[model samples]
Target chain A: MSFINYAAREINVKIVYYGPGLCGKTTNLQYIYERSNPQQKGRLISLATETDRTLFFDFLPLDLGTVRGFKTRFHLYTVPGQVFYDASRKLILKGVDGVVFVADSQEARMDANVESLRNLEDNLRENGFELKAIPYVLQFNKRDLPTAVSVDEMYRLLNYKGEPTYEAIAPQGMGVFETLKAVAKQVLYELRRK
Target chain B: MDAGLVMYEEEFDRITSILNRLRVESSANIVFLVDKNGQQIAGAGEIDRVDTTSLASLTAGNVAATDGLAKLIGEKEFSILFHEGKKDNIHISIVGQRLILVVIFDERSSLGLVRLRVRKAAAEIERVLTQMEAKAKEVGAMEAASPFAEITDEDIDALFSE
Candidate 1:
């Protein structure tokens, strides 16, 4: 949900990074947390398990300067990607304004990627949002892996909506900001449309 | 998943006044209002020591988890939650299904007093929010004329130049 505070001249939008297990959702958030100026970001909170896997979700709030006299802030969140955490994933998508689907590009994880995407669609539907109508982007992550699938193959299978897609090596920070920038822009354009 | 929140200056002022009054009357250390979506709307009292943003987000998560548990047990919802600590206590209550009100208090106040004051405050807050929602719907038609309507792709690209 986007919260527009006329009194404070601020706009807050919630964006979620969603995908299957070990798909680099948290890596994308960590990259943004490290790169953002201290004054423009809040503490990155990770509720994870002992093995460093996300238990519930990861949250990072970023203040991305101003637009049209309103200070724009985006609360970035990543859902727990393991199959057992589907309940937690649904909760995290409760009030999202936009979404970034971080698909694991490795050929071995293709089925997991497709399952996760289907889960995303079902969860958004339950929350009264249609995936095709919402502001969304796709990130084919783990592009640096030797066994990764080609971008064309990944897009052919995952880009059902033909949304803007990026090739990402999230750990190396490549395409991290690009993915964020694309979704954030769509969110702003969505606001203007409303 | 859009919660569709729109706050105006006048509505915010009114909500804050009610919150401030509740804080004084209940003698709570901090009192704040947050949307069910985890966005902090307005707050009053001594909040400098607390990170209200994180508090709001975690509180929402707690409520959501509890709601799931409630369903598992054949209940529709649990509207209020209380957690007690040695030095402080946290009380959270839902307001009109869209917002949550939280009060953090120490030994200076009693739960009974805080609950009493919050009951009155939540009703007033709910009233104000209803009015705001109605006004927003009325103004929705004119939103196409917003200053942001003219934003271009170049404008978005400039945001990342730095």
Candidate 2:
């Protein structure tokens, strides 16, 4: 649902980062928080558990310049990646405009990635946002780690056909903005089509 | 128009500088200066994926309902609402006269920081808005008409046409 404010000619869009535990979902947000210009970004909120799994969510509000005369702001959020936090993840998915599935690239985490993807689909469906209907971008994170699966193999296992995908090392800031830019651009495109 | 409504370059910088200062001072996930309807006027932190449109509508509905309920109970309108969910917690504060400030956080953040930062930011935001309202008065009543008020049933129908 679009909430248009007459006061400020700005449109707000919500995008979520989701995946299995240790997929760098939170790290992706941290990197953006660190690198973005001060005036263009707002608070970076992170929620984690005893073992450091994202407990609730991580949130970041960004001002991505503007399109036409309307200001474009992207609200980035991340759901807890651990399996036990399934309910939390679903709640976070409510009213999402875009999704970034941050899959852990390690071969051992392949099953986790697949299951997490399924979880995302299930949650979106429950929220009345179909997986294919909403703009989604895939991100294979932890590319810097040893024993990481090849991008080709990761894609074969997790790809949603034709969806934009990116290879990233979030902690080091590789491909973070590229992925954000892609998803944000797609979100704006979807709005224009509206 | 009060000089307050129109933010100067220095005022903008002041808010930005406050963001960097409060990012470390508090562990808040997202701090927003929004309207009562949930339209964010300004904010600091990671808020990339949260839905403000739905949030604003929901908040407005919540405020209205609560206010109505309070009136029924012979009480005043509510000035705040806190929604605690499994994944995120929202603290909504009515600031200035018409603006709303929301602080969204998770388990990893602190309430104290959220409060302190909001305290400073809210005062500044209220000051600017007070100036804006005054300026708006000077702009004449023609521009004061709400776009929403002008939206007709036909416009609503068109919105749902697809």
Candidate 3:
């Protein structure tokens, strides 16, 4: 849910990066954290296992300066993409304002992508939100991989809603900000429409 | 705006004062109010000593995880959570069913005292939240335009401008 603090002159919104295991959800957050100026970003907290896989969630709070007089802050979160972490993912989606489905573009992970999308829909419903009614986008990550499937096929399978889609190499920082921007823009537009 | 939490200056001050009073009455090191979604609404008592942003986010996440556990166990909700640390003990409770009330106390105060103060404060905070919700609806209906209505594409683009 979007939080508008009229007293503080701040607008806080949440955007969750979601996908199957190793779909570069955390990588997208890491790249953004590395690129953002210290004044624009807070510490990136990762609740991960000893092996570095996200056990709970990765949180990055970005201060996008201000629009009008309200300081717009986006709390970016990434769920534990592994299947058994579905409970953690559902918790993270409780009050999400926007979502970025970071689909691994490799042909081998096609099934994972589909299953994760279905999971996203179901979890969203559990939280009283419908995927189609929220500010959402698709990021076809790992485009740099030689085994990556074609963007057209990824879109054919994933972008059923025809929402904004970005081709990304998340670790290389390609399309990371673009994917974020697309969803953030949608969120702002929705806020104004309210 | 629908179902989202909007904090106006008036209600924020009222809530902050309650927190301030709770901090003093409970002899707590710090006290803060966070929305269930992890937004820091108001804080009191040595807030600078803690990272309020991370604290709020993590606290909300903890509450959320606990709620999940509650559902799995066939409970309606946990409602209250407490963590006993070596020095500073933390107490968290759901207020108004939408806000999280968190108090960090230490050897200076006992859990019973903190819980007592929190129980009283939660009632006041819930009343304020109810007023906040009603006030928000009143303003929303009268205005017919959001504060963001004046924001343009150019404004949004400028936010991303390096």
Candidate 4:
């Protein structure tokens, strides 16, 4: 849910990066945290396990410049992508304003991608939101790998809504900003419509 | 998820007053109200050293996780959560269905007293939020013409222009 605080002159939106395990969800956040100017961002908090896997979520607050006198703050979060963490994933999506599905673009992870997508839909439904109605984008990550699936094939399986999709090599920061901007724009546009 | 929150000046003032009163009466170091979705609505008391944005987010996450656990145990929901630290402690409770009231205190107060004051404060906060939601629905039509509605794609692109 977007919180428009007219009194504070701040508009806060929650955007969650979601996908299967090791699909570059955390990398997407880390790239943004590294590239954003210090003044434009807050501390990036990662709640992960000993093996460096995301245990709960990763949170980064980015202050995109003001729009119509209201400062735009997007609190970006990434859900733990492992299958057994469904409870944690549902908790993270409680009040999401937008979503970026970071699908692993490797042929071997196709089943994981499809399962995660179905999980996203079910979780969104449980939270009273329909996937089609929310501001959503797709990020086909791991594009630098030789084993990565073709963008066309990934789209055919995942881009059911034909939402804005991008190819990302998250570690190298490729398509990170593009994905962020696409989702942010859609969220802002949705806010205006309300 | 019901709708975006729109807080008018009067509603904000009333809610802040209640929070401030709760802080004083409960002897809490800080008190704040956040939506169930993790947005800091209003806060009171000593907050300079506190990172409220992150606190709000984590508190909401904690509540949601706890609620899930409650469901697994055959409960409708767990409406209150308390975490005790060595010197400081946090008490979180649900206000209505869409807001969370959090109180942070130290050795200055006992959990018993904080809980008492929070119970009273939560009632008032819930009333205020209920009215605010009603007012939002009433004025929501006019929001279509608000200044935010004037934002353009160029404005968004300009944000990343450095």
| Best-fitting candidate, scored by TM-score | 3
For candidate 4, what is the DockQ?
0.69
Q: Which prediction has the highest DockQ against the true structure?
A: 3
Residue B112 in model 3: lDDT: 97
Total residue pair clashes for candidate 4: 0
**lDDT string, candidate 3, A1-194, tens digits:** 99999999999999999999999999999999999999999889999999999999999999988888899999999999999999999999989999999999999999999999999999999899999999999999999899999988888999958799999998899999999999999999999988
| lDDT by residue (tens digit), candidate 4, B70-123 | 989999888999999999999999999889999999999999999999999999
Once superposed on the true structure, which residue ranges of model 2 sit more than 4 Å away at CA?
Answer: B1-162
Write one digit per residue (lDDT tens) for candidate 1, span A23-83: 9999999999999999999889899999999998888889998787888889999999999
Which portions of model 4 show Cα errors greater than 4 Å?
B142-146
Tell me how many clashing residue pairs each candidate has: 1, 25, 1, 0
Sort every candidate by lDDT, greatest first. Answer: 3, 4, 1, 2
* Residue B22 in candidate 2, Cα distance off native in Å: 29
The candidate maximizing lDDT is: 3
Candidate 2 on A54-127: residue-level lDDT in tens?
A: 88777787877644445666778898888987766776776678999999998899999999999999999976
Reference-based lDDT, each prediction? 0.90, 0.71, 0.94, 0.91
Pairs that collide in candidate 3 are A1-A95
Instruction: Compose the digit string of candidate 1's lDDT tens values, residues B39-113.
Output: 889999888898777888888888888888888899988988999999999999999888999999999999999
Can you write out model 4's per-residue Cα lDDT over A40-152, one digit (the tens) per residue?
99888888999999999999989999998889999999999999999999989987999999999889999999999999999999988999999999999999889999888
